[model samples]
Target: MTDDEAGAAPDVPQEPVTEPVTGAGAGPAEPAGPAPLGLVRTPTGHPGVDAHLERLADADHLAADGHVEVYEDVHRGLREALTALDAQPVPAPYENRS
Candidate 1:
């Protein structure tokens, strides 16, 4: 072994390396919209259902483009509609699942 290699300490603690801090426009860029709501891909067997899904996706994308408030309003409307649908009279339940 060389004299310098033999003399170096084997157990010394080294300074921890860190990633450089990012300033404005330095880090990874991101999409400028509310992330996708929980829409899942349905089986492509039904033509009518597939067409409806495509139309919904197109409208959602358009709403996301520089119109976040409108997108949120659509979300609210959807929620209200779902709530109203559930509130409508239904057959009596036999027992509570809870």
Candidate 2:
């Protein structure tokens, strides 16, 4: 069995080495665009809607220094929209349903 190892021609099939691709539109390495799933409740602007549109355009819901401070501007616009939606990047809660 020495005739060039019996006319060898073995390793002849591969086609399966993928692992060099990348995220589509790989732009913005991650500027933020996730979070805000369920129960988000209002906050990113217009939540209190400018103190209910200035108390219905001056209908006066007791705002003449009567201590109607709109809960500190709706708690600082809901803590800056929950700190910018908790700094985005969230996705991991899908399990097998029974």
List ranges where model 2 is wrong by over 4 Å. 1-59, 90-98
* Candidate 1 C-alpha lDDT tens digits along 1-98: 97669886677789997666555765455556654565876856655445444445544455446455554555665566567779999988799688
TM-score of each: 0.29, 0.23
Question: What C-alpha lDDT values do all the predictions have?
Answer: 0.60, 0.53
- lDDT of residue 18 for candidate 2: 56
Candidate 2 weakest lDDT stretch, 10 residues = 33-42
For candidate 2, the clash count comes to: 0
- In model 1, state the lDDT of residue 6: 85
